[model samples]
Target: MPQIPSAEALRHARAALATETETIAKAGGRAPVTDPVITPFVRALRAGGFTIQTSASGCDALGTCPACQNRYLYTALRAGLAHAVCPHCRDAADRKAAVAGAARASAGPCPPDRVGWRGAAIAAPPA
Candidate 1:
């Protein structure tokens, strides 16, 4: 009295189980992502089955995080993965760059609040 899965269903089920296991192993093996980058992606992948999540909500990587504002890539933040800045942040950065370029163009090379604009040390020009 039990029903058996069709061949395709069985294959899919097996692959899903395997992938979930793999995801767990990969997630556990790492130092663990504390970056706000991984939070929602991690939660979705954990709570929803991957295919349903992918098909219904689209891939996790396609979404942006609110806190760190990094494009969340993959279910977990693996070492090899590279993510771009969130689109919202990218727009803001671009706007700032445009304003700075305009200011430099009008005001000449030296700006009054030069240090305010720089967080890192710039290399000195030639002696």
Candidate 2:
């Protein structure tokens, strides 16, 4: 069975294509009809069950979420957030926060002395 490429591998392939596209554009030339290096990546991606669609004007490969393996991931502002986020990871974080909040609410205020910090006065002198 063919091994599925990792997220890093995918990113490297995308970056290489982008660089090639930019270089060609700067020289007043159209994007290459084909890239030797990126062709293999495209093939690997298709083999791993991803659709290959090149951007109209630039080299932007959009397919699959490298993080959670979700198809809905994108680099754009989320609801009430300035930064991008994967919905899968965000939802998981929200659920964890809710559980932690409930646990803290039931536990009441934690004692500061038990928080595991040592004062400088409690340190032993070097021999």
List lDDT for all candidates, in order.
Answer: 0.30, 0.35
TM-score of 1: 0.21
1-127: candidate 1 lDDT, tens digit per residue: 1111123443454455556667877888533334332333233333322211121223332445454555532221112212222322322111121122122311234333221121221333456
For model 1, the local distance difference test gives: 0.30
TM per candidate: 0.21, 0.27
lDDT of 2: 0.35
User: Any residue pairs clashing in model 2, and if so which?
Assistant: none
lDDT for 2 (candidate 2): 20
Which candidate should be chosen as best, given lDDT against the real structure?
Answer: 2
Query: Per-residue CA lDDT of candidate 2, range 1-127, in tens?
Result: 1223335655666676778789999999999686554454554344434332222232332334456786533222112111122334422111111111111211233212111111111222345
Model 1 / residue 117 / CA error / Å = 77
